[model samples]
Target: MAVPPALETPESDGDATSGGPEDLQRQSWTRRTFGAVIENPHFRNLFIGNIFQFGSMQMQLVVRSWLVFHITGSFAALGTVALANAIPGLLLSPVGGLIADRAPKKTIIQSAQIYNMANAAVLAALAAGWLGVELAFWHLFLSSFLQGGVNSIMMPSRQSMISDLVPRDRLMNVIGINSSGQTFMQLVGPGIAGFLIAALSPAAVFGVMAALYFFAVTFTMRLPTKPLYAFAQSDAGRAAKQARSGGRRSNGFKDLKDGMRYVATDPTIRMLIMVNFLIVVVAMPYTMLLAGFVKDILHKGAFEQGILQSVQGLGAVGGSIFIASSASKGRGKMMIGWGALLGVGIVAFSISTSFWITLPIMIFIGAAQAGRMAIGQVLVQSYSEEEYRGRVQSVWFMQFSLVQFGTFLVSILAEFAGPQVAIGGLAALLVLAMGLIALFVPAMRRLD
Candidate 1:
């Protein structure tokens, strides 16, 4: 048996990989499912930090909404709180991405965590009525908006930093692990928040969430400030530096413009972005109608609704683990399959009347959605140039914001056409959109 040339002379760097062209030629993947995440200390920190952060994020959502409802006793006020939480990222994530590209990602991540910690602490105090400060509408609204801004910056930095952690061969596996971890936290955090609020207090839950943010900061602080790959001397690196320094450094909009131009010009990158956006805008919102399905269609209560949601979360974790354990090949086709499956699953669930039937249906729906999320992210990473990775992911984050708008649209349509019909129509549209993407974007379909 002949030893491969790559194995014959492994690169001399300690981590032995880059986020750029050096990794594009990788011919073999790590055999262990979690080899990348397990072996790398930096990534281990990131993984831990992410879990803590996600748990806090979920806790905040529950606590914030609960407290707002208690204070105002109005549904519209609750909607206003959710809007406050969403608006910052919708408007500022591109700017956040630009900051990520120009600054060290670790610094940005840790800084954001610090801000979250402070914000959480203050909000917790207000909830506790500390300093005799009133829990006014503005207080809740301001905290929610600030958290959104912190998230707007933190998300892109964290995601783009993944490219720096492991060998390109292990990228898919790492992403899958991270995605699954997030889904697991989403399942856990809300439950914990509910318990905390019932047993302790909303203020106590916020205080605990603040501690989680601090935990995230502790882990993130240990991450290396510099990328393992020595890109400063590489050709692309030099060009990237030159591109940034030549008057483009003066204006943030120019940097954003360049990122948009790059996405617009690259066929594969553009297609992948569009596909991911479509996935969010269409298939992701099925979860929004879950309450309607459980309450009206299934003739159930909060307990049954919680059961159905938990089933989907479990399925999401299962699906993410499935993707992480597999070797990469036909990733593009798999993405298409997942996207279509999501739509099909939603349509199937819309028609099913039995609790048992809908349970499995939600599982498959969760799996399909999780798979699309993991695959769509990996595709964007693979297609993007290293110079633009942060900015590119920023745009991806921005597109994710529009998903709320899509869900709102779905709610409006559902008012007229019934929930099942509205959901089924969107699912059908998802299938048709994916089919068009596959047909027109041959480069995307052909991606590995």
Candidate 2:
């Protein structure tokens, strides 16, 4: 497929109508990279909605992790709660993907936001003592479980919706842009969350998250609904005909099994997701156990954790922007490169004890995480047919929950070897594994 003209690489020309040579070049760059998506009002609305969601999610992570640690004060407990949250994704992401395939994407997204808003509000209410029940870890666990379920369903719909909103050729560029914005939010959200938690109670922090979720709802309402149901070759028409003829079966398990079978059969998508899974397994436990790292390893507070998280945001922003501005050729090599870079950062992070040293390394870690995961996602979407897009993405996204198991393992290793050595040693092994794959896996290296 030809690349979309809107997202084609800009050629520098000394044009006088728009601006001078330098100014024209900058404008051309912006047009090719961002304008391809932003110029479309629907994309703009989707971007805004996603910004609120991403920011809210980051802030929620900070607040929730802090709360969990405050109450339990155990790395094992924190890891367990994180694992509990992953359970829902393991069980429901494919179902969500199936829904994304068969339903209105925007409706799925907006509905999830509404439920998330309610969930946040309830947590806030419990913290405020309005619920007439004592706040406990179980309460938080319940909230996490519900959020996980909704997220599993909502994410695929939102992801699939992007392909419908823009030309297929522009999908990766737009995903790059969106992931970059998400990384940017990671920079801002946790800093604000730390301050909020310090100044007020969990009630106020969660109330703010509720407000952000509501903003996501309002922002989504502005997006064009046309694309939510947009399907090639009149898919809706075909669906209606099938329904009338009693030819279609609404079987969730069958749909999910078929999606799994499809992914298992495709090498590009299979390796892309598998490598992504391995990387996340090795890299994510640090963030999940970050509170323990801060309190036990660094002897710091929530504020310090926020700073580290924000530093990651900085690295991720740089990494994501690089991909967004690129011509997107040789993406397979790019993914492997980012994976290797990720291991390098994690090893550095594992060995460092000082705040200053870790800050710089955190940026590298964040960049690698964003770049590798975003590229993997782009490949997953690109390799699938429209008819299977939702399910394909769902099956791919299920790897998201695998991090829970990784975190669980990290908790055990941290208990025995401490956070620094456990994470660092694991990361070193991850780097070696990635290098071996790059050297030997001809199919993976040939992804583009």
Give RMSD (Å) of candidate 2 vs. truth: 5.3
Q: How well does candidate 1 match the true structure in TM-score terms?
A: 0.91
Clashes by residue pair, model 1: none
Candidate 2 has which clashing residue pairs, if any? none
lDDT string for model 1 (98-127, tens) is 887778999999999999998889888988
- Clash counts for the predictions, in order: 0, 0
TM value for model 2: 0.86
Give the TM-score of each candidate.
0.91, 0.86
Each model's Cα RMSD: 4.5, 5.3
Model 1's C-alpha root-mean-square deviation from the true structure amounts to 4.5
Top-lDDT structure, candidate number: 1
The ten-residue window of minimal lDDT in model 2 covers 1-10
Once fitted onto the true fold, the runs of candidate 2 whose alpha carbons sit more than 4 angstroms away are 1-27, 71-77, 226-231, 234-250, 294-302
